[model samples]
Target: MSLDAEFERVSMPLENPFTISRGTQTAAENVVVRVTDEAGMTGVGGAAPSSHYGETADTVEAVMPDLLDAVERVGDPHALHAIESELRAVVEGNPAARCAVSIAVHDLAAKRLGVPLHRLWGLDPSDAPKTSFTIGLDDTDRVREKAADAVEAGHSVLKIKLGTVRDRELVDAVREAAPDARLRVDANEAWTPKEAVRKAEWLADRDVEFVEQPVPAENPEGLRYVYERSELPVAADESCVTAADVPAIADRCDIANLKLMKTGGLLEARRAIAAARAHGLEVMCGCMVESNASIAAAAQLAPLLDYADLDGSLLLAEDPYAGINLSDGEIRLAEQDRAGTGARPAEE
Candidate 1:
């Protein structure tokens, strides 16, 4: 039952400069984690530390030694619950670092069971929704071009980054480019309550499905104000970080957007989903910019989600690891042939 664990930092360039209301990212900094059992079976996971969440690659690397120590001390990869508890105990704040180990161990455990991670959880892959391809903020024309290209590439769902002075113009351009595509917009907490409501009116008129995080998390009342009046459904991304945050946002948002990096691990993400559902909210699983090492693991939870944004690796200029076949935005989980999270070095 002995296990060996290790990690490595990776810097992956984006296919394009990804911009949100908060800022832009040209690259994704990830730390890949590997957990190997006595039988030489290895599980892979990744930490895509986000500075927005008070985590960076350096922070993840700084804490890996203690996290791995906790894993080895626990010694059994199958003891996932115990392992997660140990990881939490070892590092109180580094959810990204803890998430890396969590993914790796889950991957290993699933491999040992000779099943894909979703199958291990007994989820029906057919229920999984097609993922949304994100169109990061750019000039209106460029945004339109990206939307058209995405539709041509078979992406029926597009998540557009909003929160600019010309939000209406950008939405107009995208709608013109892909009139039939399902559109969702994320303001990333960039608007005032009244402004969000006004924008939401026009956004709804344009057939946008939902408006995500229209106001800052700090202004709970503002979020509730917009949610109570917006023409479109509201989804809480920044406000709903963990399971504990769900109940507070339940009355304010129609959807709870959970990210693995924000929730820390697969188990915690599940808990958050359950909590959100319990509070009568739909669930969406999102991701930070990441490699397949982590995105693959996130994809395993697709069946349990109402929405999916697991396109992190797809946005990468090149991903050294490959997992899942998200051809044309369909999360072809049942089509996968490998065990575990299906994440492995691409060279393999």
Candidate 2:
């Protein structure tokens, strides 16, 4: 079957400036991809490249032609393994770019089969976990307000961004606002091992479920140190990028946080999850600030995740696409009766 591919860049304003330990962003720059077969069936996906990962919209755009060319050259949507392998050979470091093509191809393949992406994989959507709504770093009061707002809006799980000196105060504020919300914290590799341990003590008391990337990915030993002593479970985000990295982090963290943008494709993401599970690590599927064009594809993996932080689309001021239903933070994949990843232009 002949295939045609194309892409465009989109800049989505955030409802609020999203801040992590490293920095803040008021807008998310994404590259959206579409792969269409000769029959006119189309699949949608997006790349929200992170500068922290040495990729930007410019970089994603720079690499798209080659990535999409690889897709067209494969000439078959269901030839996922071949297409993904070729994508890697074409571009070594543009994980986000490759991921966009990957998601698009997967979407198209599933669509051609007239099934949801998860069903294509034989996953039971009922097994999917509820996703966490993130409260980005802000003033303690604003954080508390956001937490309250989230709770009022029916979010039962919340992930808070922490790394400042007043981390405890921020947690305290969130707990005050969302006392019943299942809480998780992401330091984005901002803490020292000792500081992470110390903070974990209070975070544990505050009933935080876990701490994510408290220390930098560069310090594996330090991560091990905190993993051994910290009061809360530690999840490795920065340290765990691929299946290969899972073995290295197996002894360092309790959970392996995998992102589609980081792994470069759906197939690589599954490999990472399997590798993490084989190493006795719980898996969490996370995402960059993305639209449904990609987040919908990520949602297809929810059934396989122990934890999910796929709230990327929730942070956007407006999205031009719609895929899955995350109402009240429930990844309602079973309720979405659409084919493919359920990603379609918003107007649809």
Candidate 3:
């Protein structure tokens, strides 16, 4: 069976400025790829580029044409492992670009089999966990407002962005605003080991679930230091990207946060999950600020995770695709009748 491929760049405006320790962004640059077979069934995927990960829209766009060509040559979308291997051979780095092609192929294969990607992987949607909504770094008042809005929108768990000078104040305000909400914080590699330990103690008093990437990714020793002293569990986001990083940081952090863009695609993410579990670390599936195409693909693997932060698409002002549904913070998979990743272009 012959296959055709196409890709285009998309810019999605964020509902609010997404501020992390690195910087702030009002919009996300994504590359969306689609693969269609002779039968005209199309499977779509998207890449949300992050400069922190050494990926950007221009970089992803630059590599996709050749990557898509390679995908076309492979012909059989069901051969996901071969397709991913072929893509890896064509380029080094550009995990986001490779993720687009890999997911598109998996989407196509799952659609061809007339099943959702999760079921294709022998996963049960009933086992999927609730996802957390994120409140980016902002002033205390705005933080309170966002927390309230998230709660009103049915989010029971809130992931707050820390690392600001007013980290304590921000959490205080958010806590007051949503007293019953479960809180988690991501420092985005902004704190030192000492600061992380101090902050973790403070956060634990306020019921924060965990502290993520409290220290820099390059400082495994620092992370270990913080983890040993932290009153709360420490989850490694930046430090644990692919499966290989898992073993090294397994003893340092309590949990490993896996994102598709970081792992390259669902296939590798599965390996990352297994690797984390093998090391006796909990797994959390995460995503960059992305459209539903990528979020939907990630949602298919939610059952394998101990936690979910798959609200990247929910933070967008206008998402082009529609896939997963969230209700009171719980992620609901598409009906079993729905195929592929259970995502499709939103009706214009």
Candidate 4:
């Protein structure tokens, strides 16, 4: 059966300004893709572009028409690799755009087979770990409030954003508010190697589980320097982009945070996971601030990861799609009876 594809731009407001070390976003700019087979089944996917990765809403919009055209030419949605190669030939470095098509194809294939994506992948939903709710960079009071809210919402893990002079104060405030919540921090490449080492030691004392991207992505030596001296586990978010980048930094960091937006989609994400494991680096599945469409697609890979930061949809003031359910930080995937990614447009 032939396939038809289409895309639309979407903007979802955040519950509050989501400030990371790089910048702040009051809303997320995303592109949603839908693919329909001649059989009349439709599958949905989305991309949340990041400027840090050289992708913006404008870039995504510019590349999507050709990308979708490439997808439409593919004869089989199940033949993901063939479709991926065709799309890659159409454009370069637009991972988010590639991701939108890759996921839409996967969703369509799963739907055609009449199985939920996780089931089709032979994964057990119960094995999927609980996701961590993020507390973005903010004033100490707002940090405390966000931490408190996460704890009250039954989230067992809280990933805090750091990389400022107030880093220590923010961690202290969050700990005070949610004493029992597992704490993790992402510096977003804001620290020097020496600063990262110092902060890691300080954070270890505060019971921080791990530190993410403490040093800049471009500085593998800085990452290695901190990893060698720090008492806490160091995770490479910015440092690791694709599976090929994994082996080079595998010895420098304890964990690799893989996001669909970075790897281009689930196919590459799975490959990156295997690559990380091959190099003895643990894996964390993460996402950008996106709607449920993309978050749900990322959620399908949760069973294969050691950690999950798939709360992007939860950060939205309103999500137009629904798929995964987070109860007390636990990730509950859509039922097996549902087809494709099991994420559909919200019913008003």
Candidate 5:
């Protein structure tokens, strides 16, 4: 049987751009993809939104007509290669658009197999994966306070969104607040390699994990500059969107930040992880403001990653569907059993 691609726009307001100091976002402005085959089974896909990462509702919306027009008639949506090709031509490194198409196809395929997405992706394991909660940049006192509360709430790892040149104060506040928590910082292209070094120096060995995308993606030289000088390790976020980047970015960064939005979806993300691993780079799965449909798809790829931050759903003031169990920083597979793309959150 054949499959047809369907697309729609959804807007879910965020309680806050899920503040990490780099920027702000109001809603989960997203593109929802559904691929229904001749057998009446449907697969779902979700796209993550990030204006700072160079994605917008307009870009997502604008890309859809062309994407659906091309892939709608593909003879085999389940064939990963074919779907990938159509998707790359349409969405590519654009994150949001690519993610939806990748997800819809995977969702359809998983539904056909009658298995949880994780099982289909070979990411299912008995133990749940630990997920890092975020601490958006706020006043020194507020940053400490939020970290304390969230850490007490059972999140053991904290990913701090550090804006330009604000690293010292935020890191100090976080360290003072949650001394025992594993810590990483995301610059979101806010700092230069030199500034990143200055920032990482303050918390070099004291309760600091790594620094991500200290500079912008295009400046791999700056990333390498930071990687060579910073006391803490550097990871690539905006600097990496696919497997192709892993080799080019290998020498410049110690880790790679793989977001569902960035890698497109679970399958492509998994392949990206393999490529990252092969280059001897550690992986961290990240997310933007999205629903559980996106989180669950990325969750399947978490086991293969060294770290994860799939808390985008947590930032939602309200989530319509209950997709997965994320208790105390753990993502359990309770929601993976449902049919149709394992996007249990989309069922609502």
Candidate 6:
């Protein structure tokens, strides 16, 4: 295999506003990668920007120039592996940029091997997995409306964003409107330990599925406290990014929200599941406001996870590709046989 390849970035703009803990995100763009071998095979890859992972877009945009320069310099896709040790060196450990580079390289490698992404990860490509549709923080009435719309739109389970003064109200309203809907809540580090427990108890009264990161991650001891007292199953978000963070917080919560942007990429994220399961923690594959490229990468990890929260793409105004077929909250595989979250060509 020869090394010479070309690199470029394609931005996938979102169609609508994605509301969350941070704020309402109006648009999203992903950096795309193409790898070419001397024998005439090309692989496609995509990456999300940092805003979703709590980093600035400028940071992610800045990271690509250096990463692409190095990739082009390496020449061969196989040689790209040699340059990977320097992956985090350029992105400074930003999961979005690194995730993009990682998958781009995988797409190149998968095409070389002539196999689909799931096969590379030892999973069946045809199995359909259901993902949870999100209900962002809104008016109690609007929360109920969004919840109803999600259910009517084919979502069996829903994840609602909470963690402000309206937390209890929104949860109660949603439960009232969608009584039969399975639900989960994310506080996004909006409450204190004492307050989180109180909120957990409140959520339990509404028969909510579970509360995620009700309190700050800085004090996992509070999570343990709430877990011990509340009837709800506690899940960790923004707290369990790395495998190293798993052991310390695994006992404190029952589930973890794993995002490619946070865990770095599919390779590392694949490793996190085993670590979480060993510590008796479930996994929730989630994302920031990104295109199908980002979600496609996370979809491979969804089968290994107990809960799937990969709805970031559906919230977009327009999707770039038919990356994953999501229906009734279930993700239908796209090019599942290809390696590293089989992403189809962007131009297609």
Using lDDT as the measure, the top candidate is: 2
Compared with the true structure, what per-residue lDDT tens digits does model 5 show for residues 18-117?
6655556667777777778888777777777677668887888888777776667575766777767876776665777877877777767777787777
Provide the lowest-lDDT 10-residue window in model 4.
Answer: 333-342
Where is model 1 poorest over a 10-residue stretch in terms of lDDT? 322-331
**Tens digits of lDDT, candidate 6, 1-348:** 454434445555554455667687667766665666677676655666665456555666677777767676666665544556567665566677777777777767766777666666677645545888888877777788878888888898888888678777888888877888888888888778788777777677777888888777778788788778767898888788877789888778888777778877666787788888888887777777666666776776655767888887788767665466664687766445445456665477
lDDT of 1 by residue, 135-244 (tens): 99999889999999989999999999999998999999999999999999999999999999999988988999999999999999999999999999999999998899
What's the TM for model 3? 0.98
Q: Write the per-residue lDDT of candidate 2 for residues 146-165, one digit (tens) a residue.
A: 99999998999999999999
Model 1 alpha-carbon drift over 4 Å, by segment: none
Candidate 3 lDDT by residue in tens digits, 1-348: 899999999999998999988899899899999999999999999999889988899999999999999998889998888899889999879999999888888899999999889989899898998999999998889999999999998898999999989999999999998999999999999999999999998899999999999999999999999989999999999999899899999889999999999998778999999999999999999899999888889989888999999999988999888887864667787454578987788892
Residue 249 in candidate 3, Cα distance off native in Å: 0.4
Ranking by lDDT: 2, 1, 3, 4, 5, 6
- In the range 1-348, model 4's lDDT, one tens digit per residue, is 688899999999999999998889999999999999888888899989999899999999999999988888876799899999898899978999899888888999999898889989998888898899999999999999999999999998999999899999999999999999899999999999999998888899999999999999888899999999999999999899899899988889999999999999788899999999999999999899988888888989999999999999989998888877764678887443477777888882
Model 1 TM-score on a 0 to 1 scale? 0.99
Q: List per-candidate RMSD values in Å.
A: 0.7, 0.6, 1.0, 1.1, 2.5, 2.7
The candidate, 2 or 5, that scores higher on lDDT is 2
How well does candidate 2 match the true structure in TM-score terms? 0.99
**lDDT preference between candidates 3 and 6, better one:** 3
lDDT of 1: 0.93
Error of 4 at 27 (Å): 0.7
Work out the TM-score per prediction: 0.99, 0.99, 0.98, 0.98, 0.90, 0.89
Identify the superior model by TM-score, candidate 2 or candidate 5: 2
Distance from true location, Cα of 134 in model 2, Å: 0.6
Pairwise lDDT winner, candidates 1 and 6: 1
